[model samples]
Target: MAQDRALLRVEREEVLGYLLLDSATVKGDSVRYEGRNANSHNDVDAIRGIVRSQVLAQRMERDGIDPKRVAAFARFPLEMHTQRIDDKGRDRGVQLGLIFLGYAVALLLYMMIVIYGQAIMRSVLEEKTTRVAEVVVSSVNTDILLAGKILGVGLVAITQVLSWVVLSIAAMKYGAQYIFGEQVQAAAVATAAGSPGAGGSPGLGLLAVGLPPVPLWATVALFLCFVLGFIFYASLFAAVGAMVNSQEDVQQAATPVMLLLVSSVIFMGPIMANPGSAMARTMSMLPTSAPIIMPLRITLVPVPWIEVVGALAGVAAACAASIWLSGRIYRVGLLMYGKKPSLGELARWIKYAR
Candidate 1:
């Protein structure tokens, strides 16, 4: 048994299924083996080649032919690529670069909302706890102060996002040069320009050479979506912060907003897999989710101008409402420092502001 293991070069644990082993056996010129199921195409093909060798040897020996008299060669190599289904019943190729580009953009918006909104919330909490609000509000209108804070922090967030965009572009353009050099660049461009038969797309060929997948317009839309989404959510965060006196209270106050942000991220998987699906299209129009889903749809599939315009209008309206309501709550809440106010109390504060 030990000798068999030595010959197989497979550990005892592998036989027990604790680990996987690629193995074969030879007996009386007959070969038997289980092919290794590896992730790589070449490895799988090689295993299939090994399986075919036994039949080839049997035919040769039956004919009383020497192995030296027979040879096998491939006329040409087989290449594999994926294609996209187009509008006119034609299959193009999926552009992985654009898919991931959209994913990155959507993810960035999610992070900015969750992270910077928390920052805004924390800033508001600090100013109130420290009594800094008294001195600051003495001169400045509370609404203006709230707007200024949201805008200032939002500008910082936008700057960081833009930096990431520039860095990503630089990495794709220059990193390819650094890694593959001029020779690889020429080959990739050539492959992208060529057709991969009638059934497959050449997009993957370009992706293999590190070419950018998304168009310029998608990037622009990604930025625009993030900007509008940030303002809409940040205003809510400021209100949540104002309603609470401490960080612990902020969590309880901000639960609904947090869930909304998280739901946007959760919806990303389905949207990316089927951007043209009815559900994805519907979510892309919702103001709460549009910031994340719309960009994903725009990046992965073709979206109509009407849906885009309607979504923008919806977000603008939501933003306006959040700012107006949050500003009133923030003004009243900043001065009330005892026990956290109830929802009814918050409503009264908004009414008082009006």
Candidate 2:
């Protein structure tokens, strides 16, 4: 404490805070180091790696253990290569950005799907409750009404998504200039131009070396995915809204459909981290998750053409199925009122409704 105080005075530095290790023990390869979370986690982590290792080594030598033998207990430096995943030479900053980007895109897509899906449902419920559907169904087809509602709501979402894409790109460009300076930006641009498919990083040219923008192709793909994905979910929302007699029942009926949407987000962290693993590939293909999951791979890396095609096909088919089932329910449920229908009845509606 005296030496630290003297050093602080000599260096003309102010004491901010201090850390005191609570406990440490070493006995025959059994090592324990206790720390408080109030200290930064990095500090605690570093203690385990550096400080504890040093203490263990010194104690081992004091106990007459060979220095090399004590050193042998240090954590081994290991390299692992995962199948089909390439992270070589990618800057940590770029990797972090990709992770964040995937998460952001996924969060945005999920919100839009849920928000607008419920919006479509609410609109349907309003129509049904107001007896507007009874009047409209007299002329306009329910399937047509459902499609039109989805299209209208989906178009608004697309406009917002496109605007965000454009602004984000512009902001990222300016951010690179502000952060990395013009020379680095120019160099990145040059690298990106020279390398075909570098957009997989969706970054500035060799932007991984700097900072990257999402590629134009990925933006296009994102728009298309959201469109079809919205249709897939929105149809179900419309169906749920049509089935329930009152607003109280709306949420209860919607819960199961909402669960499917929620389930997609559960795998996001793992999918974004692996992106090429079987889990990622499978999630990206399933209609329930593909809307958000496929975009992650589309933006981060170049997925195989076959996988991309298959993923889109699966989502498209799911959309068709959802529309078909929802349309049938909408046809029957729009008129039937009073009590909430059971799962069995809903199935019968699907089976028998023209």
Candidate 3:
């Protein structure tokens, strides 16, 4: 009777073992066969089934895919793939083109305005100290002499500005793509599409647009403003040089003018941050500060026609006043030398100089 019960228990366990083995095989067909003995076979099959199911569950968890929950799977990584450009010869050619064109233009403009303007002032001062102006005045009218000096210096500055502009255009045409990169090009295109008649930004977009596509009217306005501003400052610088007997005196006299220029640039940060503010509007209309402020306002934000006209008129008036003042100072001081003139003396010179 005992032997019959043991045999029955063994038979029931065999049936359960076979079912577990079949399930394990379905999940993974790499299950190991322990032996043909009934007890050994049953233990191996049960262990294999449990192990396989646990591994599958862990894998699902790691991938954020729960067995009991439904979710969509990502088909690819979350980064954009782009092909690299490997045209070494083309890249080299573009780089050289940019160096020759872009750098040349920027350097020329700087040298013309800053370097030559200083040269004019120094020349005037040297001639005045040496009393050469008295001899020149005997042969030529004072106004004629002034006109010749202004014209000669102005021509040099103009030539430099033109050369730079030409070179900059050439650089943009040849090497802009390589310099600015693909992302910048895309942004420029997007910006242009959004803002019609605007030359998006300075870097890549400026290069891509070249010369023809730029806003001609705006460019012309800026150029005119720059010319007027330079003339006004240069005349003042020449007058200051004449008033002083030495370079040290010239430096002291020119401090206020330099400060004015520096202050205008410093204010640009705040103006740009809040373009529509009353402060910005007022500063933009001031002749002394308008050259820098007006251009920034027009380029960065929506500027009203009235403000533009007001700024232009104010700057033009200031330039005219500066020319008159400079001419008066030059007429009197260009013959005086030795000691630097005081403020009171300068006022008298302007009041009484023929």
Candidate 4:
């Protein structure tokens, strides 16, 4: 009976924010109602605007006045899209593809780090809890063990990602027209209004608007970013697993790392709106967020070679630092038991451990 109150955590579930009220019309031209959705104010406001327009047109028609002229004057929506030019003075849908390509790649990197990082933590914790590490260490060096766990998992992850990338490339190259259909074709034409006569190419519509030439350099940079950034975060996760005494303590230990990861995604909209801003550049340069942010900048515009090298270098430095620190904690913590160590103890491990 004491076990009946156990709590079970579930994954692949999340709550979405929503606000809705039953609207009522008390009287003509005097109806009042209020509702808001914190997650999507634009959609809610668009609904309100559509309703208001309908009401205004109906009331004006009843008063022997045509609202068409006023509606035309109001100009329901001013349709427009951005104009993106590459360093090569090219805009044949490359920049448009770059927009989504950058966003998708960054998001994938974020998810990979979080997901695989937790997997490493869980693996470390399981071994430590079951006394497997004690026996394993008798035959193997701790540094080698740590490196093996990281590289093994990282290799599998990179392989899976490469498979997905190949499939996506094939899909975009061949089956894109059927997948996107007529709406995307119309949208491609609409977006072409900014550049004029660009969408007139026969049989290329959405493909021309969606995918771009992914250069070899960008591909190499992306691979390096994924490997280095993953190792950097994965080491920290392995340390957290070693530091904690139980599953209950794991959340608290990993919270700071999770927050660091999540913060990088929050500024994406603002960064895309102004890719060349100082905030974007700073994030791109910082080792903590460079994996995701730097890829975003690379895809958004023509970033300088120096900035790219600096960002990659920063990630490499971070990877080395985290690996070193985690190794120190891991070697001692795996053998120590009974309770979690304090911050001072972790510092001492780094400073004094052989």
lDDT (10s digit) by residue, model 4, range 1-354: 311111111011121112121223211222221211111224334545655566556556665575556654334432112333334333355344666688889999998999998999999999999999999999999999999999999998898888988898787666766865664566577546543224544234436465666778888898899999999999999999998878998889999999889889997776776666789899999998999898888777667789999999999999988999999998888888877788898898788867
User: Candidate 1 local accuracy as lDDT?
Assistant: 0.69
RMSD of each: 14.5, 14.5, 25.2, 15.7
User: Sorted by lDDT, highest first, which candidate order results?
Assistant: 4, 2, 1, 3
In model 2, which range of ten residues has the least summed lDDT? 78-87
Model 2 error, position 124 (Å): 0.6
Which segments of model 2 are wrong by more than 4 Å? Answer: 1-93, 175-217
Cα error of candidate 4 at position 241, Å: 0.8
**What pairs collide in candidate 1?**
84-92, 84-93
Backbone clash count, each prediction separately: 2, 6, 1, 0
Whose lDDT is higher: candidate 3's or candidate 4's? 4
Indicate which candidate wins on TM-score: 4
What would the per-residue lDDT of candidate 3 be over residues 233-320, giving only the tens digit for each residue?
7777788878888877877888887676667667766665555568878887887767766766554433567888778888888888
Per-residue C-alpha lDDT of model 1 across residues 151-179, encoded as one tens digit per residue: 99999998998898788677766775676
Question: How does each model score on lDDT?
Answer: 0.69, 0.69, 0.59, 0.72
Candidate maximizing lDDT: 4
Task: Return the clash pairs for model 4, or none.
Answer: none
